[model samples]
Target chain A: MTAPSAPLVFLPGPTALHPRVALETRAALADGFLSESHRSPRFRACLVAMEEALRSLLEIPQDHRILIVGSATEAMERIIEGTVTRRSAHLLNGAFARRLRDVAVNLGREVVEATVPDGQGFPGSPDRFRDPGVDRLLDGAELLAMTQNETSTGVRIPPDLIHALADRAREHGALSVVDLVTGWPSEAVDPARMDCGFFSVQKGFGLPAGLGILVVSPAFVERARERQARGQVTGGYMGIPALAQVADRHETRATPNMLAIRLLAAVAEDYARQGREALDGAVRRRAAVFWNAVVDLPGLTPLVEAGPSRSRTILVVEVAGGSGPLRDRLARRGLLVGDGYGPGKGRHLRVANFPVQTDPMLERLLEGLRNEV
Target chain B: MTAPSAPLVFLPGPTALHPRVALETRAALADGFLSESHRSPRFRACLVAMEEALRSLLEIPQDHRILIVGSATEAMERIIEGTVTRRSAHLLNGAFARRLRDVAVNLGREVVEATVPDGQGFPGSPDRFRDPGVDRLLDGAELLAMTQNETSTGVRIPPDLIHALADRAREHGALSVVDLVTGWPSEAVDPARMDCGFFSVQKGFGLPAGLGILVVSPAFVERARERQARGQVTGGYMGIPALAQVADRHETRATPNMLAIRLLAAVAEDYARQGREALDGAVRRRAAVFWNAVVDLPGLTPLVEAGPSRSRTILVVEVAGGSGPLRDRLARRGLLVGDGYGPGKGRHLRVANFPVQTDPMLERLLEGLRNEV
Candidate 1:
């Protein structure tokens, strides 16, 4: 069977973009997405198609605002700049969570940190309402933010905990924003229970890295509108209200990565035909193949405790020989696994099973590791 | 010769993209540009290739800073936001120039407007510049900005008048920034004499859009650094110093539209091998052929007067029967030209004859116009 083309598989993020994406991009370059007005009827049709597809896939409230922009980082920063006028508590456990703190700090927001040692899940049970540390920070804060999936360490803070957390924030008059870059259906976090959430198109959506999808609560958008009127613009690209205005007309403010959208439309159509449970089942099945292989390897140990609560799309492992030499050897053999992100250096290696990680591909990755480790 | 492919030509702004542009984009989709570091050796190599090629083709100064960004508008906005503070005088005759005023006004900078009625070249002499109307606008303005070719109305401002205007601005301690999107070498305006200039990949380059090339005078960059240190952080993807930092690396700040860059590299190589004069000659010759065939046709009149000062790449024609009916007629005949831009509505139609325009393509445009007009 053509020796199974040397799997140049991606680790979830910067996922494999569909071929249609390129076809449309080529068309866009020739047709010039910006050649027509963003308000044009044809342009509006494109936005409406994507928005409707997104609403069905994510099970988000139809009333929630969807603002597309440059990156998830830009969306997170905008959320901070718009919703949090006073101090806010930032929950940290992995690289993406730390990124939230960094963006908040850059935007001149007063950030209070909630600490969790690496390789650990969110404190205790999902039902546990509040962390004393988070509570102290949220005393006079305007918002509470966290990452639903710490892709760095392969941990998923249970959705029940997130609902409790969001409930607490509401009691304190603070909004809650979540970075769900890799979580989504795997954890089955009901969007009806969250205030806001965002993800980069590269991850779960299987599109290119340039576009970000944001789900902003309508109440928060009201706050963003007020912030915008005051001339307090957070980002050049992620002007929420500006994007909403364009989106209201069924369009995007900038010439969107139309190629990416076309591919997304194709995938969304496929998912709709198959059903969410079927897609989720496929991801789980792929995860199982990888999980079984990792447990069998003598020199490899699963980094995060494997369970339904942990990331089903990502598998973090601690290599017996350590990160430096092992990663180098794997690269020489032409298999690129994720390096330990941020502060998780040398001790951790991440493997992401997202979008279309087939059983054969997972087997190949494990076989490559078995020979090396 | 396969019926010469029907000349499927339009204004080069929406010109057909080379198939390779799409092929490369499809290849890159598997691992999007953001998957790698902007500072990585590979991306650096891409930048070096583009910069070296652009430098040779444009005849730009080695010491000048040339940056690649998302779009031509981004480049235009960057130049103004980076170089001009407090106030700037904008010479407006078409849509593009008016947009510059909008950008300046959006940035909270005071803008002095110097306007000539649409569809007219800068008055026969220098009287317009020395008039009380323009003099009042120039007072205390930090920079003078204008378009090299007002493609909307097919008016090309004389570079000597521009040089004189820049010289005048310099006397008043102001700089000159120009947008040469469709005007590159088809009309000569040495960037070596201006403080800043901007263009895009699509029109004159005969490549796809999505890439903006900005050339900054060394003096302009130095002044920008001084202003940035004073905490003047402008919004938009074109935050000057941030953009310049990425440019300093000779790489893009965000994941670049790599396919566009590869296509642009091919274009630059073709131009370099053919030499600038040959490229410019081809454009002028085609413009001559198209204009010669249609200029005297009934219900059509040239927008810009015939002279060396006219844009060699574009021929703007006022639809003597009014824009609507003529625009519709051309479209029905299977030829598309740009409709009036900004204030030029119902007054003009634009025919672009840039690098991509060929003699045979010119014939098809005339044939279509002949049947309609």
Candidate 2:
């Protein structure tokens, strides 16, 4: 499945680098964004502009501070390091969610984990946590973390459930961190409601991979700042308070991926100009294009049968046979989508409904699945 | 003095994006390096090839393992985190060298630091650390770290002196870590001798900022691996052993800046083709062009007067009276170099001798100094 030649990438995370976004890299060079100093006023301006664009595109609350790190994986570590003092809880259903749990464990913190098996939604499925247990899970925990849209299994914890849990965690003195890696802008997020939410631009912004954005609510920042002010140990560049210290100046402590930051600013501006409703509708429409065709496609069936828990960004499907056949068929038509993640690796297919996967490619994918599967 | 429109950047770090290196980002998009999964074979192959090119260019020994990180600053944090078990010693004379010591301190390690005043070199300067005291610096240290070419001070610990110190550290059971951030292929390095050498791609490689490269000796890897195997706590993604585990398979634990990695590989390959002599000669030639003009250029004088301890890469000069007037004079001619780092910010000048500063730019800079200064 190493189709470096494929013009279209429908993989859940990377998706496709939309032509508009791809051209931004060229613009970065033309405008000398590459050679600009990280300490310069120009870089500061770029940071301020990027923050504004991200705020407009994602409707981030005014109280949250946005940080640029390496990847969502990095975001998970920094958040856990900065926010959690002792005990942290995780709701896991897929590979990425588990990665956060692993990050905490590696950091030598107490971890409490609740899991729903692959191919099942956390709330829509029969059972993972009882109502009372949900209360117990947040109790005495410093932080609670989960992925909003699990890219691996195409299962989404309902947004309302996320807000509910955030509220519950707050009541129990726990901060909630949401990893909305593969779904942003299209999957509306309120940083205030979630407490702390982070995502990678390559996933939904249709840009090259590298930089990660972590948005921390005022409560989250206050908690971390309090901890730092109390003389608790902190990390270096990626440390919570260390990053926040420079973020106030519209700068990063270390030299960042300037070109990527510039590209995100440009792409985020594009999304803002396209209007949030139009952007979200495009995502919903393309996802529905695949979902509606599931009945006609011989072997393909939606992974999350419950519409309430299904992900509109990363659409997971279970082929009647192994996913290999359908994936191979699609490869023949020069289309590439992600194979199953974690336990579902070889048995399922994950298709991206990112803004970059335009109609022509979607049609090609649908035609390939219909005729060949 | 950010000259984004100068068409040339002579700054110390993020020197200048060579035209050849800039084109590689475009190649990345065309080849789908951006869309490819980090865990895929293609990325593995890219890593393998990049390692090979880097080895050839830097003359890294076969026993060393190369790692791709976010920045040299990230490398400082990770290296200090992984390698030092209890105590570390630092030979610091500049801002960047102090950064490593600070990283160790943040990680809660016992730090023994030795320092010399600015505008003076370690070996060339008289009376910083006595000969007997020098022995004590590395005596009980778990690791000894220093910057080979202090980009901030334009001072260098000559390679032979570095080897002497590394050998002495080894005798006392300590590891050597070198931050040749702004000097690499241009200033030769031996990973076996240095133990650990890390640099940012934007520096000597003449590429966009984002990625850092760390080359570790076999001993460095073995020590970290043994610690991990013994059930000692390690980091998550950037844990020495965790990174090594995937480095074996030629992949990063997280999705890296693939485009930056590709550009480094391409630039390294280009240097290999140009041969090490030509590459190093180009750097020396540029530095000599500036060093030779010191007498003629009225306020600007080489900061490190001792040629043996002076950096051929980051040429630091103390501006008589102040650097403001001379910097403005050069600015009018559309040339931009770095301002002195740390305390020397407004009083000294730092010009880069990176490969991207071709003869024409060098001539323009020299002419500006002669006429305007």
Candidate 3:
């Protein structure tokens, strides 16, 4: 019952995986990458390189522990479930934000959802977190979880607001766990400055899906150790301790999607060689190209107001007059975009503008959408 | 800083990923597997095929619910943590068996361990499950857990004993969860009658390492739902409900390693067209071919006693007289076998004889082992 092969063009994160990276992945798999001892100097070297590459990309200091996991969702759930030993507040602005809250609640943690409109992103100030309900909610809370870039909606939560909240949460002895699933070097958030930050590999690193990169402060590691001591340790195949052990060996614990990991390293190298500033410039340029094109399309309305607050990797577009058939028409023409998530579902589509959002590809997609509409 | 590609040959359980699978995986990545909806008929069809193929391979009833997850470990943990609401007795004869026990205990279940020598294989009597300690442990216990095939030490637990243990646990109002990480068509057991059975795609189906196939009985599923209603659901990426929903879809919830899934379907089709008896016979024949060749090799001793009770898919060899680098010598000959895990660590090397354990491959490995010794 497995489906036959189908040709697809991506308007999603990191678009098509880089061809060279893909080639390296195939070569590594063909050459038998999994059999190597994870602790071998070569594997450990890969781990060190991966950590350094990501550290440089995130503009983080060397002391932060970087563990690469299977996906952003895995890291998000692990951090929330593993680090949050008691009650916590989850700041929700979009679908992924709500997913974080759900993860906390599912883990049997006491969770209070701090709400915001989907398209509005997170509120611009920390005043919203100062309410009596919020204070009561924070009474026994041990963590404040939020998302930096809500990929479900084209909204970006400002890092300053995040830092502000982190400071407040700290006053109540709570840690901050951020789901920067699509934010990283492109947006220039320093991981060392935050308690814990995570992002998806496919979105920011211009690689294939399957790998997630997480940066945790040493404090988070101590908390994890405490959880382990309390016999509350949950084994995520991608759990941070397991990941750290594997990362220390510069290898994955299980046979990773070797193809994806290899491609990720190659993509990281490509970024490093080009320099972070150059990569950031490329991302900004690509986002501008795709966003501008989507704005000009007759049947589509930009989902976010023009400002620095908007996501640089995803462009949310509302089909003019809420036409589902029009969206389907664009999809049929090989312009695959994400359906709006959460409250915006059925009325919006998300177009990714990460590093893989090439000028030519975006132009072609825009032309196709126009012609189809 | 990706490491240089080495020419290491994996004895392959985490076997050398097939080049064809890797090729298709690259194709999947380029074509966008993640961007597709899970509920789509295309993915659902894949799920159905995978489940059917698994049932056919294991000779299980159509009524048994089949679920696929990231790895065999995830499935094992879910089954143990989900069903066993109280205490449990764990039968430990190998590394993976102990891991199952660890998972159960870590989830707040009281675990009573039943011990056996690492290389001796499972005891012959069901009375072992009726031990006073085991009986006492089952007072408030919700299940008895054990591994079918001890992949680490090449010991296959006796099915009658396992069935007896399951019956005893059920008599005490408990369930039975089996970590059949290596058990497959090597022997026959009716999964419909068992509470839960788990396996990884790599060992038996000869697929990549990413997909784990889990089959469960109606009794266990009902108990899990009851627990969920009580808000006592244990959370993990491998939670039973989430896995069940994906299982119901016959699709993986997260972006599956698509190329591997597709390859698994193709491999399953190969086995199906060839018939179960033929495939099982082939696996048995391959095991004999290697076992016979190694039975008299100089300085090599069969770790397990010779009989049908031994795991046909894995042959554990102990160095004769004393341990003096026999495993290292074989590896030098490009024959990659597993180091004895846990108690057997360093004393034995495990050679797997799964579906991919082809005649030529065995002949070459044996010839190399013979020459080296």
Chain B TM-scores of the candidates? 0.88, 0.94, 0.87
TM-score of chain A of 2: 0.94
- Number of the top-ranking candidate, with lDDT as the measure: 2
Worst 10 residues of 2 chain B by lDDT: B123-132
Best to worst by TM-score, what's the order? 2, 3, 1
List each candidate's DockQ score: 0.23, 0.68, 0.38
lDDT of 3 at A54: 68
Better of 1 and 2 by lDDT: 2
lDDT for each of the candidates? 0.68, 0.81, 0.68
- Span of ten consecutive residues with least summed lDDT in model 1 chain A: A1-10
Q: Model 2, A166-230: lDDT tens per residue?
A: 87788789999999998686776567687888988888887888899998887887888887777
Q: lDDT tens digits, residues A1-373, model 1?
A: 1123343454546544434455555455455443333444655666677777777777778778788755676567557756766577888878788878866665557788777777777767744555566568778877788888887888778778888788788788788888888876445666777778888766676555555678877776777777667775433343566666666666765445444454566666555565667767877888777778778878778877777456777778887767777776776775666777666667667776775455655666777888887
2 or 3: which has the higher DockQ? 2
Runs of candidate 3 exceeding 4 Å displacement: A1-8, A13-15, A35-45, A125-139, A230-255, B1-12, B18-23, B26-41, B125-137, B236-238, B321-324
